[model samples]
Target: MHAPGIWGIIVVAIVVILLFGRGKIAGLMGEVASGIKSFQKGMRDEENKPAAQIDASTTVEPVAQPEKKDA
Candidate 1:
């Protein structure tokens, strides 16, 4: 029945909470949220930066090659 599935989920959740404790769970969630926010901010900053500016001085100059001598 649907009730059994719900109960099973509830039991699993309770077991997980008991194993980790409330404070640990909250701290983990807080850290996850902070990470997500930082990632979003980085993405926004990247979008706001001009693409040309990002790679403005990234040209690779060709290097001179020396002739190889056979032994």
Candidate 2:
């Protein structure tokens, strides 16, 4: 199948806007922008975190059990 040209894309966009209204589209765009921003901030925070803290949070220590003695 042939890929959609610029005109086809524009027509689809217009139809979607007509169906959803401008305000709804704008709000959806705003939500998408905020979600992208939050994801970027989270990535930055993870990169800036201390390696030791990350390691400490993930590592598990083995527990020692008491030796059994036979009577």
Candidate 3:
């Protein structure tokens, strides 16, 4: 069997709207939009910041350990 046509999709949407009122649907859409905006802002902020810059002055020297003797 094939998938439902336009009418079937419309009927399902109507049922969904009836189950969850317009306000609920609108709130969900708003949340989705805010999340998108937040994601975009984070991406923009990251681009402005330098990537993994290391300072040469602060050097970490390796600790020398005494040679181990076999018992």
Candidate 4:
């Protein structure tokens, strides 16, 4: 099958933008950018954190159960 030409792509983009509106598209783009920045910040924060803290939190602790009482 023949791929869509440049005009086809442009028309699709225009239709999408018209349906969505410029402000809505810009807001969504802003939200996406902020989400990416937040993810990067979280990763950086994790990397900067101490390994001991991470390991300590992840360590499993077993709870002691009381012996069963006979009814």
TM-score of 1: 0.66
Q: Quantify how close model 4 is to the true structure by its C-alpha RMSD in Å.
A: 7.0
Candidate 1 positional error at 63, Å: 14
As a TM-score, model 4 comes out at: 0.70
Instruction: Order the candidate numbers by TM-score, best to worst.
Output: 3, 4, 1, 2
Whichever of 1 and 2 has more TM-score, that candidate is 1
Which 10 residues in a row give candidate 3 its minimum summed lDDT?
48-57
Please give, for residues 27-50, the per-residue lDDT of candidate 3 as tens digits: 999999999999999999999988
Whose TM-score is greatest here?
3
Candidate 3 has a TM-score of: 0.71
Q: Report the number of the highest-lDDT candidate.
A: 3
lDDT of 2 at 31: 100
| Best first by lDDT, ranked | 3, 4, 2, 1
Q: Model 4 misses residue 45 by how many Å?
A: 0.4
Q: Compare candidates 3 and 4 on TM-score and give the better one.
A: 3
By TM-score, how accurate is candidate 2? 0.61
Q: How many backbone clashes does candidate 3 have?
A: 0
Estimate the lDDT of model 3: 0.98
lDDT of 2 by residue, 1-71 (tens): 99999999999999998999999999999999999999999999999997854555678879999999999
